[model samples]
Target: MTRIALATASADLEARFRAATGGAFLPLPPAPLPSNPAHLFAQLDGAPAPDVVVLDAELAVDHALDLATLLDEQCPQIAVVLVAEHGPDLGLAAMRAGVRDILHPQAEIAEIQSVLDRAALAAQALAHTVAPASSDAPPATGRVISVLSPKGGVGKTTVATNLAVGLARTAPNSTVLVDLDAQFGDVATALDLAPEFTLADVVHGSAARDSMVLKTFLTLHETGLHVICGPPSPAAADTITSEDVSQLLQMLSLEFRYVVVDTAPGLSEHTLAALDRTTDHVLLTSMDVPGVRGLRKELDTLAELGMLTPARHVVVNFADKRGGLSVADVEATIGTKVDLRLPVSPATRVATNKGVPLLQSGGRDPVTKQLRRLVERLTIPETVTAQPDPDSRPPRHGRRRGR
Candidate 1:
């Protein structure tokens, strides 16, 4: 049966709709419709999303159209119909917003039934076109690799970009890099990309709901690596929520083989949200006393929260023989094995300045070679015997001190 939902305040219209659907339609709150599709879905209260949504234009035509437009983009499978007094202007606007049909305010039960039947058919066609044929095979879930650091200037972005590019080379068009460093992120600049859209765009609109729409928002790199750059400005970052980051990462994991995330310095809420979905952690830090100590604290915190993954890797960047801090010192300080150490090289700075990754340049430099090793380490899968249940984990505390 075709499921229907309605948003209206008119008793007359509600009665007619109930009769038309034979009490089968779900009625939403009368006024102040939700701002977006997500908010609307939240009102379902655990029920499945309806196949058709009917909006009454009497309360607010503009709000109805806006909601219709979002539904058109985010949930294309749901057919939208508007109830309004028919006019040339309203008809044109409704059509532009992809409303399936327009019904008059005094529509009778039979008329409403006829419109609903057509809308249901349209929705069925869309659902079939969007989804593939059913099979016994399980749905594919991609690997989510999040590169994190306790402080800035530890070559985190450099490693993330290189790893993503390397993976893309190995599996072309199968990798995506997401810069979760929202405020002051430089992933776009590192790749010399002038993005038409950024992370902010991907999390807020149709991109957040549809994998195909999300892919269109990503900025593609020359190495066949797709990227979701950070907000264009710090102010723009404020609009994104931790929930947005969580949803974005979940969607990417379903679409790509490797979802490489570049997080900000320290564990911000956004970074923590990414970690919740992460399968591996590339814990990076610089070769210095303070940096190493900070990394220790970060590791301790993650462990306490039960967020550490079995595939965790500790990477020490800017290794120097004369720095007096050996790899042993780092491993001892962080209480973890040093999985990889990248030597300091002038080539790294040059590549960053030119918006190119060392891996993309195919350099034979030691830094480049170490980065390749890190990528190889990731390629070797680690068996996940178990995952700590997030709900059972300890509550977070004092996480705001560092950020």
Candidate 2:
């Protein structure tokens, strides 16, 4: 059973969480607030880390950002859910400080359940993905790649789907695409496949393991590709646990050569779990200043949590030569090199409108070719191989290699 730590000062909030999630997992332990915010981190130091940490925004904002930072640093894998009353700035601050998901106190029980479910899944995924590292295990069989963005509308889904299709075309019998954005998944829409089933079905079903349930929910494209679409409805999103996603990816790694997960935009519980599950993470961004700034903040937060591995790749989608900011400007601003640049095409709209991916539409689109190249670079055997001595490496690599 998954364990959660609720750090809210409000008795009503705690009661609501307990009442809503009581049947889902083990009874939650009483959350005793430390004498001060500093003691909160100390309290977590020696405890058997909780799967999820739910904090009151009142506590977080009143306290320094250091508290959130400490939680992120001390319990890097823990999902930090922030419960707030109102105010957009509070949400922004929590997000900037690396809180996983934000929830209003007035949120419905279903929303709370969804958050708990997502936290559980993320924790399970991290555990499953890192379990092999406890032993002197060999390298993973397949390449696990994650597509992420700090803010939405950066074409993450489009790039992820096209990359999966490209990898399948370049190296058939070795590519699988997973949609991790359970709340707002667009992978199926992009691929134009009305899958009879979804990831939620696989999770809610009695399937023993990810591999056993994979074929049941995954739809095969005419291009010889495979895709595990997200939950059919937003309401079903929370039913999928991080463990389910992690197990699903673990099974896919054994079956396919390449696994590409289209993550939700932002470092939500779902996206964090996806990042923990994959060997490589690709940050997708557009040319907008706010988007670029958000990307930088995300990269920094990931670095702080030791989630930004050396294998992390940054891809600028909808890149245009005529854009206001050049690729150089974006790289300079983000303090990270842009590995891949996909040109903006009017055909993107046409393809999406027709419910088809650009790569499958028989269009000689530059963006399609660029996404394909990115996949090729990621799936290379040399790139997929695990490091020999992980301890001497950086924290991100150690986390990814499970050292």
Candidate 3:
């Protein structure tokens, strides 16, 4: 549960916060907003630190901004959200102070809940980065695969569809594919699924409340993979945010063994967010000048932004010796070996138009064989001999003395 410390002086707003969180946050004493600016930080420091600190910007915008800055320096772990009327000065100051968001003080209850949920997810992500997982413990979290491309018409959806089908065969019902091309996604058409629920449904639904709730929102494919298609229309896509994707992935990670994301062509806000959370990056490019050049720039950007920590495998799709660019040339241009070269197969177009994955319908042809190899790569068993298990963590010295 996310613990939110509500520092607003308005009794009505405080009541709203309590109702909106719906017992998600830990109980705390009535918040004290010290009138004296000097004591504000000290007052907050004295209280039990919460996962989030929601400040009332109406009280003292300057003092709130300064206090947010101080909290960021002194208590960096705790997220801060300033609730104020939208204003240029306040928004700028809050951003400079590293506040999570500058929201309206009188926003609807649902809005406040969404903000709190997002803050909780951010806090959890921060913790995961800082805390080391026990080597003895098997990976209980799902593996994330992000299919990315710089320009349109390079077949990102095709790669994502085949990869998800391949993974589903390996992991069965423990797989999900998200069509994150919010405005324009064809995952449903690619697989011939007329999903009743798209990503918008999942976001609007209380799927975040429980992973099981999320399952109901998924469209089960004959391939044994569940899917969350993109918005049916572009306008609805605007309602979805990067924060929504972050929270959705976190929840999905708990339930599914693998989450394959089909991102829109080119980098968008949500695509970058998906990249931030991905464990594997299947960077797909065609054997062409623009595609090669775009992959280089994409690599440079991912490197600069620190998104390369995830294992990145560059796949040269539609590769052919006679193509304008050779495999060697493409590899030299990207500064990375071509991990997998996927040839353009006639079977691909036929299967896509038929709404079945090539991996499902191609029947062990060269393309399906290659797709199977990719799944085989992901299913390699971990070497347990190198790591200690939880049972071996404690010493048994006292028993030895008695013996």
Candidate 4:
């Protein structure tokens, strides 16, 4: 029987998880809570290492971080998953403290189980990779890309959706697009695929850690792109914290070669958590004055917070010559070079409105070609491509901003 341990402070939550896990649930050992969390190491010194530790973030953020750090130092093999009520920012903090996965207080049993299963697999994989005989082999590290924007209505979702499809089309490896915007996500509608299971379904199920619930929840697009759509109801968003997002990303990274995350606008907890887990952050903005100004402010904030990394790239979406601001002027104002510029195409809006991806129409359109080139530049390192000049002239802006 699998030995699972629940370290949550809530009796109701413990009972629910116990009922769901049945006989596999292991009774948590009696351990006194330390008034000073710095003594946590001493308190758990002789205690048997849990296969999985489900910590409650409500107890204390600092305590949670301390516990995660202690667990990593004392029992590096043990997998830690945190449960919190806040958004992904907390999850990112927990991750920084050494937690492998995170979940919200209201996370479904199935979702918890999926996280547990993935954690177990990751632990086992680590053990095997570290074995004396296999020590010479290099470990596998997957790529995690985050799609972000400072302000809303900048076509971040469209860019994310098309970029994901474009990557899947260009690369032979498996790709998964996760809608992290739990409140107002439209990834499913954009792809025109109605999935039988949403992320909510996976979170609510009672399947074990090794169950197929997670794999089954993903909806495969016509372009062979797999997506995990956000919850249907906005009210459900409150239940999804930063920790949950972190856990989901960690699990997805194991199975996918490329994971494209569509984040909500602004620097919410969820957005921060996504950024923390991401290997690359794609900053999306338009040619509008307010958009450029907002992007600059957001980038500055990220830098101030020490969150900006070398992998962060600025992507200019809906680039048109007729736009009021030229590309150079936009870049000069923003104080950042535009890494990739996606041309405005009328078919993009039509495709989105009709519930289809632009890539599905064909790979021949100028916009599609640019999108494909963007993906190529991202994936291939040896191939040197010319970077667009920040001072370069912008295409003429048309009557409507073609997304």
Global lDDT scores for all candidate models? 0.85, 0.71, 0.75, 0.70
Better model by TM-score, 1 or 2? 1
The whole-model C-alpha lDDT of candidate 1 against the native structure comes to 0.85
If the candidates were sorted by their lDDT against the true structure, best first, what order would they fall in? 1, 3, 2, 4
Best by TM-score: 1
- Top lDDT model: 1
Ranking by TM-score: 1, 4, 3, 2
Query: Candidate 1 on 1-403: residue-level lDDT in tens?
Result: 8878898888789988888888999988766777766566656544567899998988789999999998898678889999999886998899899999999999888899999999999999999987878889988889999999999988899999999999998889999999999998999999999987788877875567767556656788999999999988899888999899989988899889999999999989899888888888888999999999999888888877767776677789999979999999887788767878898899999999999999999879999998888888777655222333343334343233345
Candidate 3 lDDT, 250-307, residue by residue in tens: 7888778999999988879888778767877788898999999999888777665556
- How do the predictions measure up, each by TM-score? 0.67, 0.60, 0.61, 0.61
Candidate with better lDDT, 2 vs 4 = 2
Q: Candidate 2 or 3, higher lDDT?
A: 3
Candidate 2, residue 364: Cα displacement in angstroms equals: 3.1
Report how far off residue 179 is in candidate 3 (Å).
0.4
For 1-403, candidate 2 gives per-residue lDDT tens digits of 7777777667677777867887443223345334332244334433444677776666555553445665565445666777776575776777777677777887877889998888778877766764455556765578788988988888988888877888888878678888888989988888888876677765543332424334434678888898878877899887877777767777788878889889988877767776776777778899878988999888777766677666777888778778798988998888877888888788888877787777776556787677666766776756533332233225453233233
The positional error of residue 333 in candidate 3, measured at the CA in angstroms, is 0.3
Better of 1 and 3 by lDDT: 1
Q: CA shift at 260, candidate 1, in angstroms? A: 0.8
